[model samples]
Target: MTHSERTSAQSTVDIAALPSVPKVLLHDHLDGGLRPATVLELAGECGYTALPAGTADGLATWFREAADSGSLERYLETFEHTVAVMQTPAGLERVARECAVDLADDGVVYAEVRFAPEQHLDRGLTLDEVVEHVLAGLRSGESQAQASGRRIRVGLLLTAMRHAARSREIAELAVRFRDRGVVGFDIAGAEAGNPPSRHLDAFEYMRDANAHFTIHAGEAFGLPSIHEAIAFCGTDRLGHGVRITDDIDLGPGGEARLGRLANYVRDKRIPLELCPSSNVQTGAVDALENHPFDLLARLRFRVTVNTDNRLMSDTSMSREMARLVETFGYGWPDLERFTINAMKSAFLPFDQRLAIIDDVIKPGYAVVMG
Candidate 1:
């Protein structure tokens, strides 16, 4: 059979019916995926009176609608509520623990979740306390998942708010916890005016300390922000680097040519942590059909799928993969490739990364696609 015929045939397989596909998610948010019930309970526990709705499902719907408003500022308002309820150690631990269980049930074998430690300090906890709480929560969740027969291992990425100058301290915290649960560092929030280069000292310090870092770029922002993140700040991976599409041209009959940045990313296999629904909600793309995910995947760029904020975006790894299959007619190979991309780009040690890919990811996908 011809290559196109094989591709078409592979696209028709039933993904949901497949038995146990392993996944690696490198860009989930700890604060964003709090269970709706947990949110309500935390709000009550902390004595915070603001909520968009009453029921758990209704609260989730409120978050999705608020984030879907197509305005960056509006998209961010949902986080205000999620973060508000995450101030205390109890609330933070509960959310983080549940997040692991949920992701594991959704087929994620490994995950690196991030949240700004500074934002969790509203009730006067220090930065170290904030990190400790999250790490403790993750450890608790890991033990629970293991007990339930799910092989899930989670790592923490301490995100420093870009609008704030605490990146240096956050980087230090990440490096300090490198042997523990903290695997990497990140800078998030307001990417337009808050370039990653603004935290040059932090990135430089991380580099010197042999730490890994990713930057949230080209989501609500554009290519210039991505350029600065890679060229200036030296990001190991790019969060929502969908705007790199602006640097490519799809010529006639689906033949594509890459501009310099695109070429650099593709050639070097710089991982693009592309979250489709979040990109659409934030107006990074006009529609899912127009997303650069298919093109980037076709060109063999290191494109990994992620749910940037599960509650705010109301998405999962399965949902995102299903959307891509429906839109771009992706096959099992594409899904397997994306999973491998995330594994390779994970902040785990090189040997651990290989073990996941070789032992877990490969065997799991084979069973699903067999």
Candidate 2:
């Protein structure tokens, strides 16, 4: 059979069948995935009286709508409430623990959930204390998932807000916790005016220390932002590097010719943490059909799927993969490739990463797809 015929003959998967597919999530937000009910409870616990919605369902709807506002800055305004509620240790631990539990419930076996250590400083928790609380909560969540016969291991990514001046400090915290649950460091926030190169000192410091780091780039901004992140800041991975789509040259019959930048990324296998639903919500693309995900994947650009903000996008790994499978006619082989890509690009040690790919993800998908 011809390649196209073979591809067309692959079975389509139902969305409900995706939850047991053994997903590996590389880019997700801790504050962005808080349960709506938990958000209400935390607001009450912390005396945050300015929530726009008092009811659980209403608040959830409010978050989804606000993130879909088509303005990047406005989309970010929703985080104020989540970060506000996460000031205290109890609040941090609760959210962190729940984040892990929810991902495990969605059949995510390995994940690296990130949040800004600088953003949770409203109530005066030291940076060290903040990291400790998140790590403790993740440990608690891991134990809970294991007890439920669902195996999950979570790692923390300490993020420094790019618009702020704490990247160096956050980098230090990440390196300090390298042997702990902390797996990597990152810088996230608006990408238009604040370039990742602004945190060069932090990136260079991580390089010197041999630490892993990913930079949030090309989500709202364009190719320049991505160029600086890769050429200047030297991130090991890109968080939402979807705008690299602008660099591809599609000539005749949809034959893609890689531009210099695209060639560099594809040649180096720089992992683009492509978060499709979030990209659409934030106006990164016009719609799901217009997304560069299929093109990037076709070109073998080391693309991996992610839910940038689960609550904000109202997405899970299952939902994200289902959307792609339905749109692209991706069957088990495609889903398995994305899962293995994420696992390979994970920030864990080489041995641990390989172990999961072999012992857990491979076996899990084999059973599900069989």
Candidate 3:
């Protein structure tokens, strides 16, 4: 087929078929992906009554509305109730398990879900215990997903809040569970006052241990944060690095000039976990149409789509992909390329990453395309 014909064929893909096309997610947050019914049940079990609504549907609406506040800090506030109920082993396990199952059902063949262990210590669980329970739940969830014939591999990325001082400790904890289901490390939270360089010790520890990590930068902040993450902390990937567009100059006649930072990011193939819906909800961009994902993708940057938070944004991997298609007219090839980008950038071992890309991702996309 000619190029135009191929493009026309690709554009004919039904958006409803998205859920069956395999995807890879690298920036999902565990605490932010809970099922509303599970949250209510867990809250009742844990005696945490601070939920803003009584029914599951009401609670879901509340979370979606609260997260739509257009401020990263306020968007984060919705986590208070989630973290409150997830204080016990059962809560953590159930949440982790459900997260795996939900992603699997959404056609995520491989994922690295992150959560801050320090925040789950409210009910006296130690850092180790928190990690252990979550790992166990993830393993169980993987088993359950397999039983349901939706195979998925979920890896844990232990996160430390950027505003907290326990990054070194959290880094150490991530390393401790590295051989288990845990795959990598990260720092996440509001990015206004807390720069990624503040957690240099943690990044250094990860580098020394030969482990992989991504930093939450360039979302709420700008190019400076992306520069620090790459030049200083040496992050393996960028979580929500949408703001890297600040360095690009779009000129007349379809010409684009890349400043040093943007050029370096493109040259290095640094994966940008661009969460379209969540970025808009957090005001990283005014709306999905204004997002720079298409520009970055066209520029050959290693851009990957992600669902940063499922419940808050009421999205899944398939939903995120569909939104991009609707807004940018992405074809099956574009979706396949994004999936390959995420699989390649995953913290999994090189051989394992390649295996999933070749065996699962490519074959699945081929079937969908055909």
Which candidate wins on lDDT? 3
Model 2 C-alpha lDDT per residue in residues 225-252, reported as the tens digit of each score: 9899899988899999999988998988
Error of 3 at 47 (Å): 0.6
Q: What's the CA RMSD for each of the models?
A: 2.0, 2.0, 1.1
User: How far is 238's C-alpha from truth in model 3 (Å)?
Assistant: 0.7
lDDT of each: 0.88, 0.91, 0.93
**Tens digits of per-residue lDDT for model 1 on 250-350?**
88888888899989988888999999988899888889998988888888889999998899988888888888888988778778889998999999889
- Candidate 3 — which residues are off by over 4 angstroms? 1-7
For candidate 3, give the lDDT of residue 50: 84
Clashes in model 3: which pairs?
none
Which predicted model would earn the best TM-score? 3
TM-score of each: 0.96, 0.97, 0.98
Better of 1 and 3 by TM-score: 3
lDDT of 3: 0.93
lDDT per residue for candidate 3 within 136-235, as digits (tens), equals 9999999999999999999999999999999999999999999998899999998988999999999999999999999999999998888999999999
Number of colliding residue pairs in model 2: 0
Q: What lDDT score is found at residue 20 in candidate 2?
A: 78
